[model samples]
Every structure is written in C-alpha cells, then in structure tokens.
Target: MREYNVAILGATGAVGTRLIEQLEKSSIPVKAVKLLASKRSAGKVLQFNGQDVVVEEATPESFDDVDIVLASAGGAASKKFLPEAVKRGAVAVDNTSAFRMDPEVPLVVPEVNEKAIYDHKGIIANPNCSTIQMVVALKPIEDVAGLKQVIVSTYQAGSGAGQTAIAELDHQAQQHLNGEKMTADIFPVKSAKKHYPLAYNLLPQIDVFEEDGSTHEEWKMVHETKKIMEGDMNSDAVKVNATCVRVPVVIGHGESVFFEVEDSSKLTPAKVKELMQNGAGITLQDDPDNQIYPQPINAEGSTQTFVGRIREDQENPGSYNMWVVSDNLLKGAAANTVQIAEKLVEHDLVRVPAEYYGK
Candidate 1:
C-alpha cells in the first residue's frame, strides 16, 4: 500500500474535526496528518491516529510535503489555500462553496458521480450537505426511471450553521425553560441585523437571500443538484428548486423530496424501497405501518443516508415523495471527501507526474 501525507484545513471547526476522525480510520495509508487552522487556533492540540498534532497557521507552504488535503475551513479559507495546495502538488478535496459552482470544479457525490474525480483540476469540491444526501437517495431511482425534476425542502440542523449556532440553540433552550428572554447571536443569517431563537423555532432562511428571492442556502441545493446528478453545464436537462429551513436539531438534516421520472408505469414505491435497501451508503427505513421513516434524531453520528416515506405524488403520475436524512458533517462533508481520497489512491487516478512535487 502506498502511503500519502494528508493535510486537514479548518481543523477546529465542526466538520473539520469530524474530517480528522474519519481520516484516522481511513483505509488509505496516511503517512502524516497535518492539522491547519487560523492564526488564533495555532498550537491547539488535536489527536490524529492516536498522536496529538499541534495545529498550524494555514499558508501556501503548509502543503509542501502533503499529498492530499481535506479542507472544511469554509469558503474563504478554501479559496485562499486550495489553489496553493494544488500548486505545491497536493490534490485538495474542498468542503466549501468557493469552487462548487465553477464550471471547472466537479461537484461530486461518490455514489452518484465518482467518475467526476478524474476531471478535477487538482481541487475537487464536495457537494453541499443537503445536496449530498438527496442525490445519494435519488441516484438509483434516476438510473431506473430517468429523472426529470426535483423539488426539495430541507429541515436543516443548527450545527449546519457551525459551532456558534449550536451554542446559540443550547443558550436559547435553557433560557426558555427558565422563563428568561432568549438571545440568538448565530442563526438564519449570523451577520444579519436580527437573529432568531432556534430552539422550538423554524427559520425559513439558512443563508442570505439573493435577488431571485431564493436564499443562498436554497440555491446551493438547487444548482448543486443539477451539477452532481445531471452534470449539466448548460443547466437544461434537470430542474431543481429547494426551500431550506433551519430547525433545532443539532446534527442531521431531513429533506422532503419530490421528484418526477420519465417512466412512471414501471416504477413503484415498493421497488424504490428495495433499491435503497441494497444501495451503497443508504438505508431504507420506510415502514409506515410500524411508524418508521427517516428522522434527524435517529441519524446523528451515522454515515448512512437514510431514506423513507416513499409514496406516489397525489396529483402527478410520474412523481414520488420521499424523506432523506444524514449527518451533515459526516456523509455530507468529511466522509465524502475521504471517500474521494480513497478512490484516488485505489484508482491511481492522478499520480505525481515525474518529480511534480520535487519528491
């Protein structure tokens, strides 16, 4: 087995921490794990493969001896250092929106489009958390029935907003129980003038709204779906519209998805359930008679994308309704990035071309 040196950027953030945990158990031979973060977080000790590694300030030089970089440090950090990683001869699998929409970057879900990994221009973009689970659930169906359109609404967890948002939820919940006034400093939109309490509350907006009346979070799902599943640069074949809401849950995201297919007569909800039961990284939990369906509370800390509530749409012949759930930080971000790195090693997709790294 060939050994690869890996670097993890944003080592302190929620998804970044999970990335470290996943990489520790990864099949790829990780020769060295370098944890990189902001200046303030430098010297922070994080354990990887049972050894404590001190976090370092992120810089172009950070990738000097790195072979693969898993970055979850947010879009700004990815935009700054991902190219630098590439220039220094490391392939960056970024968990940020910075390169997701770029025509050159592949928005990948390994189950749906692992082949996209071959096309990376040294940096590969992971799909949005919500988008990842949905596509994983829908991919098998799309292969069988031929997808036409997707309409999805997400019940996203507070943790998706990051650690501060999770703290805000805890603060608000405790305050509400004590009959004290609740304060929210991180949620909906953290920089917006007003923040709403996330405990026992639903905020229709996840990210700031754009001019098209869709919030940026919603638009990520919309555009990312088309890119990952359909691979449509022209954006004409697949249609997607998403409504993203922030819920009080701390880990998993639940989505209610409605999709239309070309061959409705051959497909049924039962067949879909059977397909999901045998699909990779997916579990079918749709036993409505026993009162079971995919729920966020049951999905925390798990890598599986859970699907349930498979039924035909009432008004549309070729359409079906389903529920999708997964840990936003695991299968959605870190696990997907790690899976790509494993694929790269297994396939020998991009070998360091003749002294490319001056190795």
Candidate 2:
C-alpha cells in the first residue's frame, strides 16, 4: 500500500471542501494533505482524517514534493496555479474549464473515458458538472447503440455557481416569503450586467451568452459531450445541443435528455434501462407503475447519476428521452475531479516528466 502526498488548491471553497471530504474516504492511501487557498482564506483550519490542516496561500512552491493536486479554484486561479503545480512535478486534476479543451490536456470523466487519463501531459481536466452527469447516462447507450444526436435541457442548481450563489438563493427565498423585494445579483452569470432572481423562478441562461445566442454553459455541454464521447469536437459521428437553465434548487441538477440512436431497431426504452442499471456510476430508477423516477431532491448527496423516465419518442422511433439527476457539487465537480486522480493512480499515470521535478 503506497501513500501519496496530495494538495487541494482551493481548500476553503464549496467544491474544494467537498474534495477534502472525498479524499478522506477515498481508497487511495494519503500520506499527507495540503490545503491551499487565496491569501484571504489562509490560516483557516480544515479537518482531514481527524487532524487540523491549515489553508495556505497557493503558489508554485506549494506543490513541492506533492504527488497529486486536486484543483477546484475558479478558472483564473486554476489557469494560474495548475500549470505551476504541474511544473513542480505534481499531477493536477483540475475542476475548472481552464484547460479542458486544450489538446495537450485530457478532459476526463472516469466512467466515460478513463483511458484518456493516461494520455495527460501532467494535467487532467474535469469536464463541466452538467456534462459529467449527462455523459455518464449517455455513455452506455452510445456503446450499445451508436449515438447520432443528443439534445439536453438542464435545470441546474444554485450550488453550481458556488457558495455565494447558494446563499443568495436562500436569502432571496426568505425575502419572497416575507413579501420583501427580491434582489438579483448572482444567477445567470455574476459578472454579467444584468442579474435575475432565481427564487421561485427560472432563468433561461447559465453563463454569459455567446455571439451565436447560446450561453457559455450550453456551449460547454455541446462541445464537451463531443470531446468526451468521440474525443474530437468536429467528429461527424455525433451531434450535441444543450439549453442550460438555473433553477432555485440548492444541490442537485436535473436534466431532460433526448437522444437519437443510430441503430434504432435494437435499442428500446426497456433495453436502455437495463443497460443503465448495469452501467458504472449510474442508478436506474425508472418504475412508472410505482411512480419511481429520478428527482433532484432525492439525489442531493449521492455520487451515482440517477436516471429515469426512459421512453422512446413516438414520432421518431430512433429518438428517445430520459431524465438524469445528480448532486452538482459532488459528482459534477468534486467527486469527478477526485475520480480522475484515482484513475491516474490506479493506472500508474501519476508521475510527470523528469524536467518538471524540482524545476
């Protein structure tokens, strides 16, 4: 049993905190744990394996002698610190979108593309939280019956935006209940000029809108699905489209996914359910007669992707629909990021080039 030294880059934040919890219970033997955050969060003590670990300011030097780096900082911070960690000989599994689409970095969901982890050049990118759940449900189907197209509409949770967004949702709900004015500031992109209240209402946008009218969140789903499934965005084999929305939920993300199977005659709703039931990291909850199905409330803290509402489109026999749910913070961000690190260790891919060591 070999133990490895690990560092968590954003140890005080929502996803960062979850990463700590996941690592605590993980099968990987952790010799030492380092908690790194920004200067403001430094000196905060977090619990790991029944010991107090103080958060330190993240710098290139923080990666010294670390074997694995689990990074959940924001995109800017990840873009800055992850490379430094890699350069310092630590294999960084990143939860931010900073390096996902980079050809040199591997964007991996362990259940979907574990082999991709071996191809990493010192850094592995974790796909967007929404993309991770959708792909988990779709991967088995894609294998049993070739996938031709995918269309997904997501009802995302406030936690996807971080702790501030979740807290704002709670505050706004209280304001609505007390007949006070609801404030808008975080949902639908915090940096955008216009913000909206997500309490008892839905916003049809997740990230900032692109030039093509699609929000950045939707674009990530579109492109990331392709990258994870076929490993190339331009692959003519499969097409993906998404509409991401922010709902008032606090933890889990719910999605309605419609997909077309290339070989329609063989793949049916029952077969799809059977495939998913046996799929890794997936739980089949489709029992229409008993009113059993996946829901956000039921999936709050679970790591497995809950899938239900399996049915084929009546008009198009080739097209089918299903519902998917998972905790956005756990499986979507922290759990998946940690899973990539686990895969790296399992496959003995945790080491980088010699030049990166002590450089």
Candidate 3:
C-alpha cells in the first residue's frame, strides 16, 4: 500500500476538524498529516489517528513534500494559498467557493461526476455543502430518467455559517428563554444592514442577496448543480432553482427537492424509490405508512445522504418530490473533499503536473 503525505488547511475550523476525522478512516494510506491554520489558531492541538498534531500557520512553504491538501479555509485564504500549494506539487481539494466556477478547475461530486476529477489542473473544487447533498440525491434519478429541471428549498443549519454562527444561535436561544434582549450579529449576512436571530425563528436568507433578489447561496445551488451534473455552467439541459433558508438546527441540512424528468412516462414514484434504494451513498426511507422519512436529527453524524417521502407531483406528472438530509459538515463539506482526493489516488491522478512541481 502506498502512503501519501497529506496537509489539512484550516485545521481548527468546523469542517477542517471533520476532515481530520474522515482521513483517519479513509481508504487512502497517509504517510504523514500536517495541520495548517491562521496565525491565531497556530499551536492548537487536534487529534488524528490517536496522536495530537499541532496546527501551523499556512504558507506556501507548508506544501513542501505534501501530496494531498484538504483545504477548508475561507475563500480569501484558499484563493491566496491553494495555487501556491499546487505550485509546490500538492493536489488540492478545496471546500470553499473560490475556484468552483473556474473553467480550469473541476467542481466535483464523487458519485455524480468522478471522472471530472481527472480534468483538474492540480485543484478540484468541492461544490457548496447544500449543493453536494442535493446532487447526490438527484443523480440516480437523472441517470434513470433524464433530468429537465430541479427546484429545491433548503432548511439549512447554523453550522453552515461557521462556528461563530453556531455559538450565536445557542446564545440567542438562552437569551430568548430567559426573556433577555438577544444580540444580533454574524447572521443574515454579517455585513448587511440588519442581522436576525436564528433561534426559534427562520431567516429566509443564507448569504448576501444579489441584485436579482436571489441570495448568493441560492445562486450557488443553481449554478453548481448544472456544473456538477452536466459539466457546463451554461448547460440548458437541466434548469435549477433554489430557495435557501437558515434554521436553528445545529448539525444537519434538509432539502425538499422537486425534479422534472424529460421522459415522464417512464418515471414513477416506485421506480424513483427503487433507484434511490440502490444508489451509492444514498439511503431510502420512504415508508409513509410507518411514518418513516429523513430528518435532520436522525442524520446528524452520518456520511450517507438520507432520502425519503418519494412521490410524484399531482399537478405535473413529469415532476416528482423527495426529501434529502445529511450531515452538512461531514458529507456536505469534509467527506466530499476527502472523497475527491481518494478518487484522484484511485485513478492514479494524484501526482502534480511536471510544470507545477517546484514552481
């Protein structure tokens, strides 16, 4: 078995910590593990394979002799250091939205488009967390019956925003319970004019709103779904629409997805259930009689995407509806990023290009 030296950027973050855990159980044999983070996070200890690894401040030199880089740092940090890591001979699997839409970079969902990993020029972008699970649930349907459209409404967790948002949700919940004035910060777009509490309430917004009145999170779902499924951002084959909302939940994300098939006569609820039941990385729980269905609470720590409530739209026979749930930090972000690295190794595409080595 060959072992590769791996580096995890943003080692102390929510997703970064999960990456460390996944790597411990991953099939990829790891020769060494390096933990990199911001200056403030340097010296913090994180456990991996039963050993404590100290976090180091990330720099171009950190990629020296590194084979794989799992990057979960913010967009700015990824945009700055990922290229440097690639230049030094490490294949980077990025979790931020930094390079997802770049023509030179491959935005991949392993189950949906594993072949796209080979097209990478030293970097592979992991689709947004929300997009990752939705595509996983829809890929089987798309394969069995050609997909024509996707409309999704997400019930996203506080963890999607970051650790600070998670803490704020908890703090606000306590304040609301005690009849104290709740403080609003780090939510509904922290830089926006108004901040809202995500405790005991839902905010119909995830990221900053675009001029077209769609949130950035919604646009990512719209654009990323096309790129991951069809391999082109401008593909008109599958039209996607998303409505993202931030709920008070702490770990899992749930989505209500309605999809239309090109060949309506061949697709049915029972057939869709059968496809989902046999699909990779998917669990079917569609037993309406027994009240069995996917939920965020039941999906908290699992890597598999839970799908249920399979049925066809009464008004539109061509369209069907299903519910999808998964651990946003694991499968949605960390596990998916690690899976891309594993695919690269499986296909023997792990080596840095000759032109990028040492330059």
Candidate 4:
C-alpha cells in the first residue's frame, strides 16, 4: 500500500476528531498525521494509532510535505488554508460551505460523483450533511424513476453545532430537570443574543436565517444537492427545497424526504430497497414487520448512510417518501472528505508539480 502524509485541520472540532478516528481504520496507508487547529488548541494531545499526536496551530506553511489534508473546520478556515495547502502540494478535501459552489471545485459524494474527483484543482468540497444522506438514498431511485423534484426536512443533531453547543445542551437539560431556571447559550443562533433549549425541543433553524427567511443550512442543502447531482447548479433536471431543524440528538441527522419521479409505475418500495441495499455509502434498513428502521443511535460512529421508511406518496402519484439518516460527522463530513482524497490519489489528480504547493 502506498503511504501518504495526512493533515487534519480543525483537529479539535467534532468532525475533525471523527475524521482522525476514521483515518485510523482506513485502508489508506498514512505516513504521518498532523493535527492543526487554532493557537489556543496548539499542544493539545489527540491519540492516533495508539500514540498521542500533539495539535499544532495551523498556518499557511503547515501543509509542507503533507500529501492530503482533510479540512472540516468551517468555511472561514477553508477559505484561509485551502489555497495554502494546495500551494504546498497537499490536496485538500474541505468539509465546509466554502467551495461546494465553486465552478472549479467538485462537490462530491463518492457513491454518486466519484468521477468528479478527477476535476479537482487541488481542492474538493464535500456536500452538506443532510444533502449527503438524501442523495445516497435517492441516487439509486433516480437511476430508475428519474428525479424531477425533491423536498426535505432535516432533524440535525446538537453535535453538528460544535462541542461547546453540546455541553450547553447538557447543562440546560440538567437545569430543566432540577426545576431551576434553565439557560441556553449555544443554540438558535449563538451570535444572535437569544438562545434556546435543544433538549425536549426542536429548533426550526440551524444557521442564522437569511434575508429570504431560509437558514443558511437549508440553502446549503438545496444548492449543494443540485451541484453534487448534476455537476452544475443551473441544470434543469433537479429542483430541491429544504427545511433544516436542530434536534437534541447527539449524533445522526435524520431527514424526511419527499421526491417526485418522472415515472412512478416503473418503481416500487421493494425495488428502492434493493437498489439502496446494494448502493455504495448507504445501508437499507427498511424492514417494517420486525420494526426495523434507521435511528440516530444506530448510526453513531458508522460511515454508511442509513435509509428506511420508504413508501409511496398517497397524494402524489409519482412521488415517494423516505427517511434518511447518517452520522453527520462521518459520511456527512469526515469520511466523505477522506474519500475525495482517496479519489484524487486513485485518479492521479493530486500529485501536481511540487512547486504548485510551495510559496
């Protein structure tokens, strides 16, 4: 196996931590693992291959000699370090909203758009967490029925908000149980003065609401889905609408998806199940009599997208309903980002002129 040096930017974040864990079990031979984060997190110890790897402050020069960089930090972090990593000969797979829409960057789901990896100019963008699972569940069906439109509602987890948000939820829950005045400091919108309880409550907004009233998270799913499926956002073949909500779950993001196909008579629930079960990056968990289905707890730490509860829409003849679930930190971000790096290697798109990554 070929060995490659790897870097994990935003190493202390939720997705970043999971990315390291996945790398531990990955088939790719990792020569070295560099953990990069902010200056405050530098010197922090994170375990890899049973050894403690100290986190270092990230800088444009940090990518020297790195073969692959899995960046799950945020849009701002990606905007800052991606070019730097690329300049240093490291191919970056960013798990942020930064480059998904860039005409030059391929927004990929390995199962659906792995070939797009060949087009990477040193950087690739992973699709949104909700968008990733939905596409995994819908891709096989689209191959048969021909998708025209899709509407999705996502139940996102607290972990998606970062670690501090998770702690805030736990703190508020304990206060709620103790009959004390509970406070919310990390939800609804952290920057927005008012926060709310996530436990025993569903917050209808994920990111800050835009001028059009849709949250940025919802818009990311809508636009990113089209970009991933069709390769261009302007394609007329796909139309999507999404409502992103935050729930108290610590892991998976659950999506209730409704979709319309160009032809319905050619497909059925059983056929969908068969295709999905055999599909890449997806696990079909649709047994009804045994009361089997995809749940958040069942999806934790797993990279496969879980899909179940598939049924035909009663109101619309060519429409269907299904539930899609996944470990947002894994398949939604980390695993997908790693897969892009692997694809870059497999397609020979990564190893550019060494000077291409140098300052």
Candidate 5:
C-alpha cells in the first residue's frame, strides 16, 4: 500500500498521453506524478487522475526522487535520459526501441513474458507494436502447443508512424476525394528520399530497408520475438519473419499471423479457442457462420488483444492462421509500459541492479 513517485518522460505525445491515462486507471500506488517532455512541450498542462500537472523539460535532475519512469520518448531521448533515471534510483520502463535489443534489458509483453521482468537491470523494454500483440495472441497457443515459427503480415495504422502521419493520412484522404493530387511526406520512412501517400494505399515498408531487403520493423519483429519468447537470446528455436505495411487506418493495428507449433495434434481451432478463452487479456472472436472476426476499427481504444479468423492452413499440416488486433498506442506502447510498472511494484523489484550502475 505504499505510494511511489512516478515520472513520465515525453508526457505530451500520443503514446506519452496514453501512458498517463493508463497509469491513472492502473492499480499502481502512485504517490506523486511528474510529467516531463521536451522544451517545446514544457509548461503544457495535462490532467492526471483529475489534477492538472504541468509538463517539465526532461533532464538528469527531473528524475530526482522518482521511483518509476514510464518513457515514451524517442530513442535518442531514452538513450539520453533513462540512464540518469536509473542512476537516481528509478526503475524505468521504456517504450522506444532504444533498449529492446539490449542483452541487459527484458523485452516484455506483460501477458506473455511478465516473469522476465525479474532480471531487469533498472530498465525494462516494451517491444515493437506489432510484436507485442503478436506475442500476446500467441501466448495461449504457446501454452497449449510449443511454438516453432511466427510469420506475420501487419496492416498497421498511420498512427503507428506518429501523430503527424495520422494527420497526413487525413489530408490525403480529403485530397483524394476532391481529386487533388495528394501530397506525400511521411509514409515509408521520414528520412527516405522517396515518399508515398498512405491514404487509401498500402506501403510494404514500415521502417527503412536494411541491406538484406528487410525493413527495420520487419527485423524487429523477427529478432524481438525470438528474444521475448526464449530464455536464450540467440535461440533459433522459434523462427519469426514479418511483412510490415502501413494502411489507411488511424489507431488500431491489425496483424495476420501464420504460426507453426511443435506438435500439430495438440492444437486445432477448438483447442486454440479453449486456451484463448482462459488466456489473460486475450479475446477470442472467431466465428465464420455469422461473419465475426477481429478488426482494427473495433479495437481502437481497448488495450485487449483480439484474435479471430482462426483456421488451419490447408497447405501446411502443423500451421495455423489468425487475425490479431490491438490499439497500437495503448496495448502496444502505453498500457504495456504501465503493466510492467505494476509488475515491478507487485514483485517488490523497483530498485536498480548494482551491475547496471554507470551503464
């Protein structure tokens, strides 16, 4: 029943604001809340649990006396400020990709790998948006039949790119309606030389392409999945590959996941439904008779991961396919971070590990 002082880095952005809302609704004992952002966002007032809190520019001193920090800032900001937070005795859960691949950090989805938090060296990592929902939907299957491979094709929302990309989609949609030439700036990659309109179209690229012809987002899903689902960082036990696409939607992200289990006999649609029926934070919406399935529009605001369109792959005996949907900002980023913070308190493991000092 002890309350802890909490600091939220990047308190004004999309995911940052959702983090605040999740914290407000979470069961963590919050003694005091601090809102930290960039200088441009400083002095902006936001409500938390009905009280107005002004955003402060984040710095090393901002983390003083903070017990927990929910960081949704960009990689640079997380790389810059999280160590300071840990140095000042705060256990931070990061939403950026900064520490997810780090051997020292635990890449977690609460419903899937919550126990891995026990090994955190002060900073726990939230996995990629697509990876988070995929793992959550797969946990039930992994419990029933061991996982061997994960192949996901994501129809992600423009919001996944950021707040600006959402607005770009809106503008382009209107432009298309008016028959005006839609402008392109933020689709494939912000820094890429060529850009494309994301309204009423799909871009197969999420992040920049690597030399191997896979986007960074795809690589993240491939590698991060292996790390989160395996105790061995380099384990090839579970194979993961992703095809990421940016769709016209605004909030929720949808994934078509094809997975192969170790034992085919243990899992069928009925048995998968049985496991999902008892799974934590999972919703089984599979129904082919009346046309029921998970959709991004129906999943926008909720943090729960929805699964539907479950069926066995005709081509492969041991593989199955399902549709997974969740709010990209909530379940994928903000709510997941809050869940980790709650686990930290519940397990009484909030202090920084000694080995992580000056690291």
Candidate 6:
C-alpha cells in the first residue's frame, strides 16, 4: 500500500487531539504526520505511532507536500487555509462548518455518504458533530425506507464547544458543590454578550441565535442532514428540524429523534431495529425491558453511533422515535474526518479534481 503524508490542523484542541489519536488506530497508509495549530500551540510536541511530532503554526505554505489534511480548526482558519491547502496539492477533510453548505463542497458522514468523498474539489467537509451522529443513525433507515421528515432534540456535551468549555463545566460543578455562585465564561457562546454555567443546568442555546431565533448549531443540523442524506442542501426532500441544548456531560452527545419514512411509511420499530442491526457504523441497544438503551456515558469513547429506545409514534402513523448517542469528539468530528480521508484514499482521490479548480 502506498503511504500519504497527513496533516492535523488545530492539533492542540479537543477535536484535533482526537484526530491525532484516531489516526493512530486508522488504516490510512500514513507516510508522515504533521501537526498544525496556532502559534501558542506550535512549539508543543505530540505523538503519533508512539514517536514525537512537533506542532507547527499553520500558514498557507503548511499544505506543501501534505497529501491529506484533517482540519478541526475554527471556521476562520479553515476558510483561510483550506483553499491554500488545496491549491498546494493537498486534499483536506474539514471538520468546520465553513464550507458545508457550499454547492461545490460535499458535507460527508462516512457511513451515510462515503461516495460523496469523490466529489471533493479540494475540500471534503465532515458534518457537524451532532449532524454526523444523527446521519449515521438515520442512514440505515434512509437506505431502506425513504426519509420524509426528521426532528431531533440534542443533549450536547460541553466538550463540543472546546477544551475550555469542558474545563469550565468542571469548575462550575465544584463551585456548586461548595455552595459558591458558579461563574460563567464559555458555555452558550463565548463571544456572545452573556455566558452561563453549564453545571447541573442545561442551556437551551448552543450557538448565537440567527435572525429567525434558531441558533447556528440548530441550523447546521437542519441543512447538513439534508445535504448528507438527500444531497439537496436547500431542498425539502427530507425535512430536518433541530433543537440544540448544551448538557452537563463532557464528551458524549445524546439525541432524541423522531422521523417519518416516506417509502416505508408503515415501517415498525422491529424493522427499524433490524435495519440498525445490519447498519454500518451503528450499534443497536434497544432492549427497554432490560433498561439497555443508548446513553452518553456508555458511548463516551466509541466510534459507532448507538441507537435505541425504538418505538412507533402513536400520533403519527408513519413516524418512529429513537435515541442516538456517540462520542462528540470521535464519530462526530475527528473519527469522521479521518474516515473521509480513508474513503478518499480508497477511491484514489488524493488530488483536487480539475473540475473543482474554479469552485
């Protein structure tokens, strides 16, 4: 097998760290590993294959000689550097929302849309963490029955924000334990005018709200799901609605999903479980009698999306309800990013397509 030079952007952050760790266990034929972060993280040393690799400050020239770039940096960095990386001959799997809705960029969830990796001009987008797990859980059903509508309520982990938010959650927990007023800093939105404590509390907001009163995170879930499953970014082919909330957990994200199948409108819970059992990259945990449903703690480190609590919606004949859970950092971002890179290699799409040059 031939090897490719891989780069990890935002190499010091939560998702970036997981990207490095995921690459260690991944099957990509990696010739060399390069770690890229901001200047503060540049001198830091990290490990891949048990050897030390120094993190470098990312620049436009960072993509030179890099075959694959797994980027989990902020949207700003991705918007600025990914195009340069592509121009310099590297195919990037971006884990930011910067280009997800772009008509030319394919927002991919490996289990749901592996074939979409071939459509990359220079960048393949890893869907949002919440969107990734939801699509993985939905793909099996969408494959068998056609999707009509999807409504998801997410219990997102603080780690979804970044390492700082997770740490702040811990601090707030301690403060509450000691009867001190908890301080607010990163939760909700960092740059927003106000912040809130996430310990023993849920923030109904995930990101700053848009003009329509929906947070950006919620909007991503809606549109990203449509693009990945239906390949129609703005089309109502599969109606997606999301309510994103920040839970007190540190790593795993849990979602309550209700979906209606168009083709198999009469699809029962049993059939749903059967599809999930045979579904790629998903685990079935639907034994309610034994209290064995998917939960965030149990899904803390696993790459597979966990689905359970399957039942038919009583009010709606064609609708079913279920719970989906996965490690936000793993299958949601880093693992999904690396999986796209693996698919790219499997399909020999290491270079930007000439057709995408003008995009």
Give the candidate number with the greatest lDDT: 3
Q: What C-alpha lDDT does candidate 6 achieve relative to the native structure?
A: 0.89
TM-score of candidate 2 versus the correct structure, residues matched by position: 0.97
lDDT of 6 by residue, 1-359 (tens): 87999999999999998999899998899999999999988899999999999999999998899999999889999999998888888899999989989888988887777777776799888888999889888888877777888999999999999999989999999999999999998888999899989999999998889899999999999888878877722334688989999999999999999998887554777899999999989999999789999988899889999999999988887799999999999999999888888888888999877765335
Clashes of each: 0, 0, 0, 4, 0, 0
Candidate 1: give the clashing pairs: none
The residue-by-residue lDDT of candidate 1 on 130-191, one tens digit each, is 99999999888887887888899999998988877888899999999999998888887888
Ten residues in a row with the worst lDDT in model 3? 229-238
Each candidate structure's TM-score, on Cα atoms with residue i matched to residue i, is: 0.95, 0.97, 0.97, 0.95, 0.97, 0.97
Query: lDDT of each model, Cα atoms only?
Result: 0.87, 0.89, 0.90, 0.85, 0.90, 0.89
lDDT of 5: 0.90
How much does candidate 4 score in TM-score?
0.95
Model 3: lDDT to the true structure = 0.90
Better of 4 and 6 by lDDT: 6
Expressed as tens digits, the lDDT of each residue in 1-40 for candidate 4 is: 5689999999999888888988887767788999999998
> What's model 1's TM-score?
0.95
Worst 10 residues of 1 by lDDT: 350-359
Error of 2 at 185 (Å): 2.3
Question: What is candidate 1's CA lDDT for residue 129?
Answer: 93
**Candidate 5 lDDT, 1-359, residue by residue in tens:** 77899999999888989999999999998999999999999999999999999999999999999999999889999999999999999999999999998888998888888889998889999999998999898887876778988888999988887778888899999999999999999887888999999898889999888999999999999988888888523335588888999889999999999999989999877887777778889988888897889988899889999998888889898899999999999998999999999999999989888887346
lDDT preference between candidates 2 and 4, better one: 2
